[model samples]
Target: MNNNSNLFLCKATRNTYEHRRSSLLCQVCGDRNARNCFGSVSCAPCKMFFRRNLDFDLVINKCIYDGNCEMHENSRHACRYCRFKKCLTVGMKKELTRPPRLNQKKRIGKQITPPLIRRLDLLNSNRSKLSFDQWSILSNVTHVYDQISPLPKILNSLSQSSFPPKKRLRIDGATLADMLGLIYRSIYSFLERIPDFTMMSIHDRNLLIERNLHNVGSTSGLLILRDGDLYSNYAFCRANLNTYGSDNFEGVSKLLNRLDMDRVAVKLFVVVLAFSTCFDVVRPSNMTNNIQLSKSTNRLHFNTINMFHIQNKYIDMLFIYMVYRYGYIEASLRFAALLFTALQLCVHTMEAANIQEHGDMLDTIIADTTRKLNVEDDPVV
Candidate 1:
């Protein structure tokens, strides 16, 4: 608290080594803290500790069961796996360093965990979502009408302090061309609706909107739009393409068509975005432990279950965003998308009742909206 005090109050070790050598890091972990706290990189464990427990939990449980909790870097022994999990939740890459393979050649490389593998697959999974399960069961559900529109009882349930603790998730995706088609339509509709003047020029808007469209197609998910870098391309697209032909109409149309082929990328962006909305992905620490921190379940097991529920309500939440982030997504599109998916599964179980054509609350929305909008303005409305 005083100027006399040093920056790092060392309890175990100091930041400098005895030699004349110095690293661009603190002796303890590398990098300066009281400085670039966020940008500073340390070994895996320390990074995790800083990320997860920065605020400091009032009630931290120690892992006295066995000082087995590795203190290699950021291992905060004062808890269950919560500290480590917090790190990843905060964006610390666990497998960042890739520990060396068995140097002795005496044994095979360490087997990777399913969760870790799942994480990798999610990050780099490029499989085709060429087919979708029967749509009839999943249709009636809509993000606005079914799950997200109203403040659902479930969300309120979680917020209730009087309620018993939060329950862990138990339950828990693709079709590419159709996926791209839907997202493209949404983007197209979004662009078409933009007022003329708000744009630097229609050409400028077109390129930005076009690139936005292309990014979605290329990534096949709505999250594609979130990347600031990709969206900027639209600005340049209009500037360059406009100059290339300066109002050449056919050139513009050709560009649209060129981007259209990236429907896979766009659709993938939506799919992934939909998945996030469908699930919390990152389970809260208390919630995770309460639910059973099955070390066996790979990282994605958490993400999978989170997104699945989100899908249950909207089934179309992410798709809605891909189509049009203007309204539904800003409003918890993913939450509904996942819930709708669940509603479909519920239909399967109630098959004897023939629940396929029977629409849920979402039908009410369509009916209500349809009544107000006349035929001429109907589509726009």
Candidate 2:
């Protein structure tokens, strides 16, 4: 019994081997395994079942028996729905079926050449020269700065019915700090837009910014006030007066009244503030140095030659515009007034810095300018 059984097993193994298919049982229906069809190993009956009813109707050909119908080779054809489901359960990929190829002829459109773009060497070509305008460069630079700077939305003046006399803003230390921070940040934005400002050495840039940043903010505030853009006692934004307590509002109101500068005057003042190069624009005392040389000329001996050049360009543009707008005498008076306002701004900045609450904000302005210049703890000259 043992010998016959061993001989029969050996013969069956040889037959399965000669058939060029795995002797392992089929994964789908537990029948004799064949070559892989799609992605899974299954017998011939399951493979044919899958291909024939690849898109079989599950509802119409529903299994009368439980979904677990016997899917062996002999019984696979009895339920096309269950057989296909078993094929998928065994990991057969339906997407392996290839789509039919179309035999339509391709039509090509007529070839047309693209128009040639002429390249001119701007460095050598006279055709690339910029035409001179009285204030085009200055105007363009200021316009770009104005576009990026954070100024308040222009609202109608306090006299306009739009600004109803609402209750005065509640002033807190936090609100005061925020207002001052906004002003300094706006000035920093304007400074960044100056041509060659970032390109200058970090030391020169920081010095130039620290020297004149206060005046820039002041000039912006003055411009807003002079243009009647402030509502009630607030500077451009209503938050401007939220920093000033009831006690300080009177002083602020008086200051705003004195800022009667025209648009041209305000622009010239902004240009002046942008170009200030003196390291100590906000001096402790009335300095004779500013009176004698002017800030730009004073910085000539230092490594701020690049800064001086850029500043001089703006200064020259301002002077030319002033002369064009007004005769020399009137221009001189306007220039003097703007210069005085810069000095006044320095005083105002100093007073604000001396306030206990503003001390941290002043430090923040220095830290921010240092970070913007990409300088380390100590910048090299």
Candidate 3:
């Protein structure tokens, strides 16, 4: 066979394998066909098994086979402990499982509560409006952001340094590269903590990172500047100043100063940016250099639909939380401002990347961080 034929066959084989791995076989047992259950692709048996054994920790730990039992449709029943462990390992969420529905016949007249009583119940329920799952997502995203953010470390280092508070810290190409590297790594770490992101195929995850990390990093940079108060101390050195010019720095400062500075809102926006398909207001003349646009070859392999779904969740959460915290009119204005700021940041980031050194630095940072993430975890099947 010619090279083209071989390549075609290889691609076909890989796609088939991926489809089977993701949609056909049970994620836990790898034997029966699967369906979406409790936030994972699992067979009915595994779904029932997990629902029955809500205390998964207690059940899985009492393993007779030392937690290493090989599970399949036939052998899954042989070891309940390992089977349940596999279910959890494959991203099955207990919280996603619904409680058994009450018999409608038994509760037919229960809905006829007094109007006053119903009003009181509604008023009380409205006191804490967010659902458990929404709260969980909000808490998880913010906690992950806090854990991976470099601001605290940067602040500590600044406090311990002997440099004068008013004196500017010179940021050369190398220093700038290092700062971006830390930001990229933190963004990568933050994304890894998200279940939906982690559940994607390795190809999809890497593609998202390659195309969107820098744009996301721009938003992240604002958080760092706002949180660390780095605007006063950090300044680009003469070489970088000439390369990026003063206007870019001023733009960043202006955006930072104008931002409303809601930590939760910013964190959720970062998540939204990470999954964004394109950041450009206009198509770039050189698509190859634009981190905002996915390459054609990569676009063919990318799970755009899945990414949109994931992005929508965070976007919804962001808006809902903003409305809950700030009133509707204020939330609407803040959201518009946040998006405008993001666009300005993207323009600045693209301009910076047009410089050879800045572009290379971003590429290196992304490659290094991608390698680390791939090494640390196997892609979810």
Candidate 3, residues 1-381: lDDT per residue as tens digits? 699999999999999987875568788988656888998888887888898777546532454434576676655654455677788889998878755554564476577644455445543444356678989999998988988888655444433234442332343566655665677668888888899888998777767777788788878878886665455332433433656788887787788877767988998898888888775332322345545444655544667788889889888788878877875557789999999889878888878777787777777767777677677676567
Tens-digit lDDT track of model 2 for 1-381: 999999999999998777756576677778875768778887776676677556666665444335676666545543345677788888987776433332122112223433324442231233223237535665666686557544332221211233322322223457546655665677767666655665666656666665666657666765654333233233223444444444344444555656534565566557666666662455322233355556544433346566677767766666556655664556667777767655665566566555666656766776677676764446577
Q: Which stretches of candidate 3 lie over 4 Å from their true place?
A: 1-128, 156-171, 234-243, 280-301, 373-381
Estimate every model's Cα lDDT from 0 to 1: 0.31, 0.57, 0.71
CA lDDT, candidate 1, residue 258: 32
Residue-wise C-alpha lDDT for candidate 1, range 1-381, written one tens digit per residue: 653354455521364542212333432233333222344334444554554444443254322223233222232332234444444444545344333553434343443322344454442322222125313222322221122211123222212334222211110011112222343334433323322213233333322332233332223222322211112222222433332234432333333333322232233233333333222222222234535455423322323343355434333433433334233222245445433433332222233112222222222322332332224233553
What's the lDDT for residue 337 in model 3?
96
Give the TM-score of each candidate. Answer: 0.20, 0.49, 0.58
Error in Å for residue 65 of model 3: 55
Better of 1 and 2 by TM-score: 2
Quote the RMSD, in angstroms, for model 2: 29.7
Q: Return the lDDT, model 1, position 150.
A: 16
Best by TM-score: 3
Q: What is the clash count for each candidate, in the order shown?
A: 58, 0, 0
Candidate 3 residue pairs in backbone clash: none
A best-first ranking of the candidates according to their lDDT comes to: 3, 2, 1
TM-score of 1: 0.20
